[model samples]
Target: MPLSSLPAPTSSRRVLITGAASGLGLALARGLAERGDRVLATDVARARPDSVPAGVDYLPLDVRLDADWTSALAHVRDSWGGVDVLVNNAGVATGGRIDVATMDEWHRIVDINLLGVVRGCRTFTPLLKEQGRGHIVNVASLAGLVHAPGMASYNAVKAGVVAVSETLDHELAPHGIAVSVVCPAFFRTNLGASFAGADGDMEAAGKRLLERSRRSADEVAAIVISGIDARRDIILTDWDGRIAWRVKRFARPIYRLAMRRAGARIASTSHTIE
Candidate 1:
């Protein structure tokens, strides 16, 4: 189904968001709630984190657990009757060259960043299918669309999200479920604090990029909400992401050159974390 033909988002929606304790997830929860949506904000922490906006329901959800997913589904069913949206936004961050990143690190990131989203979709998709009208929003990153050097694990998992989201968009269209994959550039968020890669230089570089980001979590969340409302299949939340995607698609040679330059820079400065 063409996006134009899909139903527009109603004023009040029942939105379930994972990783809502802080950063982008928190911002998203607040944004949706402020708009009068019934928001179920969840996080992995045993106790609810401070600063979650008032009037939003809180739940403890570690996206990696099947039990948690099941419980979240049950909670929504009991409270809201059914969910209008599922935001698979719980993820951790890591960055290292493939040679430097350990198999254990790769496994951990993939389990959380990629499989976490998978679990959410797998658990909630049946409910969406039953309702025959809903949405799935997966939070990816600019790295998903533009693979940068020294971020093999992060890029791979985020790209997996983008791919899974795309596949679901087509597969679920007939079921009246729209899918949106958000590809936002680095923004001011706690994502960097979760970084646990093997390369010190890569980690430093990533932190620097994040520190320089002009947009805050709330700003990016607002753009993402707009994209969801518009029912966009791919939501590039910033001009940087938008331009990068276009360059890769329409100006391949330039994109390749830029990537090569970035790789060379990383290669020159790369060093293992002690």
Candidate 2:
């Protein structure tokens, strides 16, 4: 379907969001449901989260598990006939310099952050193909595009999400499936709780950034919904992200210098316990 074929804003599309127990995922679920969309809000927890908004359905879905995806698909088919939108929002947070980060850390982040989105896309693309009209939204981060220091694993995986979303936008356009990748800069969320890195200071630094952010998850979720309605292929949800991306694209010299300085500062500050 063409971008113009997307359902109208007033239409109540069936939407499914992963990691809906908390953070941006929870906010998306709430916003979409309040807008009258039939929402299935899923998380890794087996029991329904009390934080889930009223009238929204709940399911247990660990994106890293194949069986969970199968079950989610079954539920969607049985309950909603089929999905009109899929939001792959589940991910973990990790940060470390190349040498400081362990292979296990790299593998775990890739499995949960990058491949998790990949699995969601693979699982639902066939249904969207048959329907010939649907949307897939992947939640990435500014780190995906604006690579800074001490977050190599996170940057790589988020960049992967952006790449995969772009590829699918083209590949699925012929099949009438719209794909969007959302890259929001840091915001106030419990994402810091999920932080896993070789250096404790890296996690501390990430938390500080999150604490300092002006944007909230709810605000970002609203932006994402608007972007999806507009059928945007790349949605940058904040000014910081937009500015950073523009600088990287249009002012390479400045961006490079900034990154070098950030890297040097991090290298000087980062400390790992033996």
The alpha-carbon lDDT assigned to residue 140 of candidate 2 equals: 88
Number of backbone collisions per candidate: 0, 1
- Computed on alpha carbons, the lDDT of every model, listed in order, comes to 0.89, 0.89
lDDT of 2 by residue, 128-180 (tens): 98899999999988888999988889999999999999999999999989999
Q: Any runs in candidate 1 off by more than 4 Å, and if so which?
A: 1-10
Task: Give the Å error, residue 43, model 1.
Answer: 0.6
Question: How big is the positional error of residue 215 in model 2, measured in Å on the Cα after superposition?
Answer: 1.0
Give each model a TM-score: 0.95, 0.96
